[model samples]
Target: MNEPLAQRLRPKTLADVCGQQHLLAEGQVFRRTIESGRIPNMIFYGPSGTGKTTVARIIAENSGMTLHKLNGTSCGTGDIKAVLKDIGTLAGAGGILLYLDEIQYLNKKQQQSLLECIEDGSVTLIASTTENPYFYIYNALLSRCTVFEFKPLSAADVERGIRNALKKLSASEPQPVTMDEDACAYLAESAGGDLRKALGCLDFVVTAAPVDEGEKHVTLGMVQQVTRRTAMRYDRDGDDHYDIVSAYQKSMRGSDPNAALHYLARLLEAGDLPSACRRLMVCACEDVGLAYPQIIPIVKAAVDAANMVGLPEARLPLADAVILVATSPKSNSAHDAINAAIADVQAGRTGPIPRQLQNKHFDGEDAAVKGQNYKYAHDFENHWVEQQYLPDVLKDVKYYTFGDNRTEQAARAYWAKIKGEDKL
Candidate 1:
């Protein structure tokens, strides 16, 4: 009778499922597929506690097919061969639903073997992964499966799940557990859109309560005792690590200090200072380039200081760097300029280097060398000279569009004054 609360309250039918209305809602194609009892090879991808496994199980139950579960991290060629062997006998009657959890862990070789099963439909492949399928799963295998992305459950859905688990506990135990409204809300919100985590917390609180009879009432204090400060669910080496760092950089680029700091705190808490520092440096140059170019050195200095002094103290300079980048005038002209030039080269626009601009520093090289025609800008007024710096093929091409920021506007204006026009 001592079952984990999350398992005990797992949604039996799709209707019982709480979140994922985008896919599970009425008239959705996925919903229709599940109801028709004719499921195709599918890949469920999302964060933890997002009901990917639960939905796969629901499909298995509704499809009336024998469910063969495999952990992708551990299951090998032998396991797949055994399943394929079983499919010959068992799948002939009702077909088979193979639920592979953590499918990203399946190496390229294992995935190649699984591709055979998918192609022949020996078993209806239902793979669930926390990592992005497009990034981790093999392209051949991914193309064969319909991907459904599950989002983190909303606060309301998590609250509902908490209430349902409490009801189940009350129905089963003589001394029903009662949770205060504030305590329930706190637990649900602190779960951070993770229903299974909420249920587990509730179970732990109810089980460990120091009560021998009657109803044990849970309060906010008790909830905090079990949930602590609700650590920011981050994995230092996993997809979450990259995801949070990406968010941090985007937040800085988008000029949102609030989101930048939020992601920064998460990174620091997860001990991912190196990623945080790297992202800030890139953001400073890529997003704030030329507009407020001084910020680049500032960010680099902050990063250097952070690396020299780790942790609690490191967070200070990081916070300062993030705030500075988020508040600075944003521009991507430099970043775009490089990319545009690279794209031209990639598209066969790579013209040879202008003879004048070619190196002439060799021992025997002299004014008669290929780059002898090079004009010295310092020889002219204002240290400015208009000459063909680019290759002949790209002479008319323009890159490095000036941003709206005053610093770049000044550069544009100065260029116009010297060159008689503003186009580069």
Candidate 2:
């Protein structure tokens, strides 16, 4: 079988690697460490196509260690044992360097098996995981290894990689393979920071592009045909899901309708309507609270409409809710009030309920002693009356601070007038 273009284009040295400048840039700690030739047990944590495997290979070649590759998905304790058995043999003379990919898939026992080899210096481990290492990696193993995070490449970085891939393709093929500038830009932007994905797309386009006068010409249309939908890094059960949802709600709370819509579109593109809907409703109440009280029901209605219609169409109602919440006057007084009350209750600051406010039905013996003196507001002027509703300990404590927004200020004014405290 032919070697995949992405595989063929893999960086042979640290100098050739694209992106990950944070880790691999000149004078960077990681780059210095790798150059020092004293490799440590490390974990590479990041999304796919960020060059974790490629970097490991480079490290293995430089470290003078016998490199052994195993995937967590298929390897078991037996496979680990097989690798460990070579510790004293000629194959392990230079010391073993184990590059375990998808390390998150390995169970506790499987990971635990590596602890001994790692401790004794028999194996220098370089594990790569697409998921969060702290969440999936074994605690003991995690403690022993230094973790290095790999961030997604920028569009410019991916574009650099695409240019390099084109150069390599032209040199390897009998007929020159050239991509139009627009097509190169389109492929890079569409890759969503995954070099492997960009190379894969280029590979497909080159193989499928028609040869004109002994040259394969790749155009914007060819790139578009290969990547109709842009790559989106979202796993419903993963960290990206939570991150995007957080950004989605925060954008609305921050009152940036454009940013809010951008995140909303990402969630909808990932087919995560439930997360988008739930966040919109919460933002309406939490961020747009008393200032725009009616937005609560308005967002709820939009959410209901979205759930009924379902995606594509669902995005419309959800978009309306997102925009409404984003543009609405904002307040967190109601949310803050409830949280403060809950905290006081949790801290046992709540005393006995006032005698008048206590349930009368269960006060058979105490009814006569306590007296049913609950004042009725209907009989008073302005249909309002002062009453102590909180427990004795918290009677003087105020939790609901009226927000500065017009609606809340108006309500504050109305209450002050009704109580004849406006002059105070």
Among the numbered candidates, top TM-score falls to 2
What does candidate 2's lDDT look like per residue over 167-226, in tens digits?
A: 989998988998899989989899988999999889998999899999999999999998
Residues 343-362, model 1: lDDT tens digits: 99899997778777778644
Estimate the overall C-alpha local distance difference test score of candidate 2.
0.91
- C-alpha displacement of 216 in model 1, angstroms? 2.5
So what's the TM-score on candidate 1?
0.88
TM-score of 2: 0.92
Question: RMSD of model 1, in Å?
Answer: 3.2
How high is the lDDT of residue 25 in model 1? 92
Error of 2 at 116 (Å): 4.0
